[model samples]
Target: LFSQVPLVEIDGIELTQTRAILSYLAAKYNLHGKDLKETFRIDMYADGTLDLMLMVALAVFKTPEEKEKSLALMVKKDKTQNFPIFEKILKEHGEDFLVGNKFSWADIQLLEAILMVEELDASVLSDFPLLKEFKTRINNIPTIKKFLHPGSHRKPPPDSHHVEYRF
Candidate 1:
């Protein structure tokens, strides 16, 4: 509803995914990194986080047998393996935000990652203090803080319309 509503207009330039939308906005508004190469690196990390969250969401509502299988695989590859890779990038780029010191599309991607897993299991973040801190930091930002709370336009859609991955 948000994208096609009274105040929201859908542009003809079609981007297929959330990450693409973020990237397009960032580049258009100069919220991307210092240059093209840095922008690509930032996007790569953001996309990786998106992929990980998608896997976790799949595991959350699967049937018992399927859930168990998905959980085992994700715990190994998604959390244990893939998470640390992002962690290292965040640490290496340890300026308050990902991809240079300015807030960029990467921050939005990371916020989505945290939100995706937070409802499933808070403990999923226990191993990554930086990730936890990153979420808190982003949410506290004046602009982002508005959306983090209820009643904001960016609040998640009602449950009925949201994607539920029951198996």
Candidate 2:
């Protein structure tokens, strides 16, 4: 059984890998853009989202001191280096969603990554008003609210390597 997470079954077809499955569903459901190039752009943003998540994951696997050091390096990199790209994207889009001005998989992917960072340090996003607004708009949507409500379902128990800390 393909019980691994990110598994999706549609019309007797099984899908694996979060990004591949999401892109497929977006195309099938008409959630993606009208043009091929737009889809590529969305994929680019999604890739950036995955990169941020990977940075978060990197810290999770290290010893406590290493985790602290890693996170410190991550924060320094985030605060001084990369957030401007996201902030600029938000301003350029000038809408609730990232590309094509509608809710799409890129928005979902980035939002998920942002929330992960928030769990580490909510203040990080406060420095970027547009990003903060982007998060708020996504979070306040009726569908998103219902899907992510606190009581909806239990998250899996923390694994042995899980480390909880705050900045």
lDDT of 2 at 166: 25
List the candidate 2 regions with Cα displacement exceeding 4 Å. Answer: 1-6, 9-11, 153-158, 161-167
- Residue pairs clashing in model 2 are none
lDDT of 1 by residue, 27-113 (tens): 876778898887887788778777766676555455668866765665556458766776787799687887777788778877877
Task: Give the alpha carbon lDDT tens digit for every residue of 4-80 in model 2.
Answer: 55578896898988777877887886767668887788888888777766676666567768877876776666666
C-alpha RMSD of each candidate structure in angstroms:
5.0, 4.7
Q: How close is every model to the real structure, measured as TM-score?
A: 0.71, 0.78
Give the residue spans of candidate 1 off by over 4 A. 1-19, 56-78, 154-167
Error of 1 at 74 (Å): 4.2
Q: What value of lDDT does candidate 1 attain over all alpha carbons?
A: 0.69
